[model samples]
Target: MDVMVPRVAALPAAMELLDRLHDQHGPLMMHQSGGCCDGSSPMCYPQGEFIVGDREVLLGVLDLRLFTGQVRPDAPEDADGVPVWISAQQFDAWQHTQLVLDVVPGRGAGFSLEGPEGVRFLTRSRVFNESEVRALAQQPVLTGADWDTGARPPAATRPQVVTDVADACAIPGG
Candidate 1:
């Protein structure tokens, strides 16, 4: 019964990306996965391909596919293997947010984008620093080394696992 919508602050960027996608792909849905804090970030899809009721928007030249999901949370620690933890409540809140955007060409065979407002300049190149790729791979949504290959792993893989060790401390003869 919990209806999760993208935070309203992301609307402008989402709308812009949606329009650009429509212009390029002629109304289709654009799907993109990857984020800093959550599992899946926002990406745009062309109009008809991802029909939101009856509105069709376009980007410059790329078609988009719209899929709903949460943004990938930031790595707990930087690539240095530091420890990080986001509370379950905070994570749950983020899980309900949505993003909309289109992928654009990068300088050296990579991609950039028009993401949520202040984040429009965000960009990534085909060549990733060894550490950057490693950090991204740590996300449940990205499995193995295939993340760098432009393959979307799966949403079901993002759940965090926790194990209680108290039972292991039971005394045999206390």
Candidate 2:
């Protein structure tokens, strides 16, 4: 199935959260739970690992290690017939925290964004169902998935220079 990379437009709330994360934590990693075609959500590694589906995407950035993987199309169906993508272990770790998936529709093409908060609609071309949102939110990560254990490296140290290039290039007498 053809998968598309979703475009992220952080809303005020999302942007605030992102800034808070950057200021307190570090870079952000993303993942997703649901989408079209076999109902598989493709895992994307934007900075680290960002998962993308036909209509949803997830963005994550944390100090803890987390499991991740792609959802199988033929996976066993939940009570609602929507397949489970993410694994149980991952769910336990992410429990209590709300994950949001944003959906966007384009001309014959569309994408979604999923994170630990609310979902944002990107485009007006496509339609989605409540079940679809739940399915996407329910996507799972692989058991024993890799995690980011190391702390984000400190921002590059500013170098000490003898002279400023711009000032040095200025006309001496001018």
Candidate 3:
């Protein structure tokens, strides 16, 4: 009975920034930037603002509790976590580690929601232990492009396929 490890989690400071952004904007989502400029930084957007295609992978919700690796029983009942995403290809390269979202003093790379706040969102990672990796692989990884219509999965759009967990690594979708 292992605690299910989250593929992505935000540091408390990063969560604080997310809160500020949510107050200014609205429901939010994040995408992992892999190309020029950002060099693997995380981009934030208003939920439904960014179009998720087949190549995107839903890293999982960034609930306040995810960083602790456990969903608190006393957590807010209405906690609809901020969804985080990575390119499908990025997921493959990062699947062996845990993706940690953090904030730093600087301007965000692109149109991420936090750009104007004088702090930029960045990703810091840790290689998962064998047990943690197993836990992550066993969880259902949602592939955004499969049925995502700029909406979150398992409730808004069609539920993501969970059977794909049988793949080489656990996070299920593509």
Candidate 4:
């Protein structure tokens, strides 16, 4: 089988933060915001805290080895690493580059779990060269069903919020 390149990747510093967050938060996930205002920054949250919708996408998952001393309550006794996610639309624009999730000391404006730690997560990117782009082109891109039930609207379709199970079911193949 061919190995696929991930749409999102983390640096060691970001992994360290993820390890610390996982120690306290149990498990974690990230969402890359596409709206204005702190939207450009990726927000980290305790798993399932945020309501993922069709507008969002799962860019990739990160496996940050549990380096923190505390074992999360929900983690298996012998759990190895934690998982993280990124938004799909954000990935479309950034597909040609590699994302490096990092942390810097500063207060971030958003509900991201890390905001209270006096630090926030940031993304650093580098463009993919021809070879890397070619390799990435061969990889399968993640869609809504691959990560969650929410189905993104077609590019020509306007997006709407699914307020309840009924609304979610109303979506085509949602």
Off by over 4 Å in 2: 1-6, 35-174
Winner on lDDT (1 vs 4)? 4
Residues 1-174 of candidate 3: C-alpha lDDT, one tens digit per residue: 345566766666777777667657766788888778778789999888888777788877765333333343554522436788888888888888767777789896678888778989877765777878677667667787654554443432211112221221334353
Q: How many collisions per candidate?
A: 40, 22, 2, 1
RMSD of 2: 20.1
TM-score of each: 0.24, 0.22, 0.74, 0.71
Off by over 4 Å in 1: 1-9, 30-32, 35-40, 45-93, 96-174
CA shift of 54, model 3, Å: 2.3
Q: CA RMSD for every model?
A: 19.0, 20.1, 9.4, 13.7
Better of 3 and 4 by lDDT: 3
**Candidate 2, backbone clash total:** 22
Better model by lDDT, 2 or 3? Answer: 3
lDDT of each prediction vs. the true structure?
0.28, 0.29, 0.68, 0.61
Q: On TM-score, who's better, 1 or 4?
A: 4
lDDT of 4 by residue, 29-126 (tens): 78776667895887888777887654455555565442333444665642423334456656677777766677789988989888888999887665
Question: Sorted by TM-score, highest first, which candidate order results?
Answer: 3, 4, 1, 2
**Per-residue lDDT of model 1, residues 40-133, tens digit only:** 4334333223222111111112111221222224522111110111223333443232212223332211122233323432211122235544
Q: Give the number of the best model, judged by lDDT.
A: 3
